[model samples]
Target: MAKTDQAKADKKRQQDKERQRAKRQRDAEKNSSLGIREYRVTLSQTEADALTDLCAYRGGVEPYGAAEFIATLIRRDKQRMEDEKAHLGTCDFCGEPLPTGCKNGLGIPRLKGVEKCFYTRDEKKLRL
Candidate 1:
């Protein structure tokens, strides 16, 4: 009886160690770039279907499926923003070099959701 109890205890310990090891592996993978996460967004059924369809259009911009395509598209947009900074707008109140430069007169007049540009103290004082 004593021997059987000891064996059961050993088995439980081994199982626990294996579970911990697997958990660590999962955590490491999540921290890596290739890790996966859940993202929720609202869309009409038609839009959802369109997105699923678009995923097949390319050989898949990435190694994964539709999620990767969405990620790639987001990355592409951000890259385009940085690369095409000349097209951005500047802050009217601050006169700072806006993200993508200014558009229209006085450069957008300070938008709520727009990315702001960096301007020197002198630029702010210019009143331009």
Candidate 2:
């Protein structure tokens, strides 16, 4: 059954909230691992006024409510860089296309006159 417009909108908002929470958790973990902590600072009268004006200028979305946006941006940028590297054709020495099965690894797939892709070296031995 098709969802109503309001239902779809509510679902989207819920998803966005979940994603934001996840990002915040990840960033908080990273900070905690580094023995760091986050703190809120009190702004001066002028600064607070400027911040209030800035927040108001932001249409629809609340600026201070943008939790973990910076972390999400960083994650996306790293993914994009990795994808670019993956698309750079096969290895010249081995004549193998890059592997796309998983993330955080650089194992390339080799034709090597075999029926299917094979690795010259065992992935477990290799440092991913």
Candidate 3:
């Protein structure tokens, strides 16, 4: 069943709230290991007002998420990475040309016959 736009916005709002909570918790912890460092950005009154106005102005089919915009930022960042990778025909994480026919990491000819993809070096690493 297709969800209505209001429902989608609600879901996104809930997701944003959860992400904001997690970010806040991580940012509040002292020397936390979540790798989510909180940056203290001080803005003048006018600058703050301008940012608020911008957020309100830039809102789409959902509520203005203020500084806790998760979907927009993540989607934009992913799109940027994909665009760059496509343009260069290489992995964004590792600046190397993609394989011609190799499906997985098989040591590409450029890497001296070393086949490494986006996950070859990252998938096996310790991930929490």
Q: Model 2: per-residue lDDT, tens digit, 1-128?
A: 35688899999999999999999999999999999766576779997777666555652375633234434545778887687656645544445444433222444343344333233333232223
Using Cα atoms with residue i matched to residue i, what is each candidate's TM-score against the true structure?
A: 0.44, 0.33, 0.34
Candidates' RMSD to native: 10.0, 19.3, 18.5
What tens digits encode model 3's per-residue C-alpha lDDT throughout 103-128? 33554333333445444543333222
Best by lDDT: 1
Candidate 3 displacement at residue 80 in angstroms:
1.4
lDDT of each: 0.64, 0.57, 0.60
Residue 109 lDDT (model 3): 33
Model 1 Cα shift for residue 122 (angstroms): 24
Residue-level lDDT tens digits of model 1 in 4-84? 999999999999999999998888787686666668989899998888777777645543476777898888887876665
Question: How far off is residue 127 in model 1, in Å?
Answer: 26
Evaluated at residue 8, the lDDT of candidate 2 is 92
Ranking by TM-score: 1, 3, 2
Pairs with backbone N, CA or C atoms under 3 Å apart (clashes), candidate 2: none
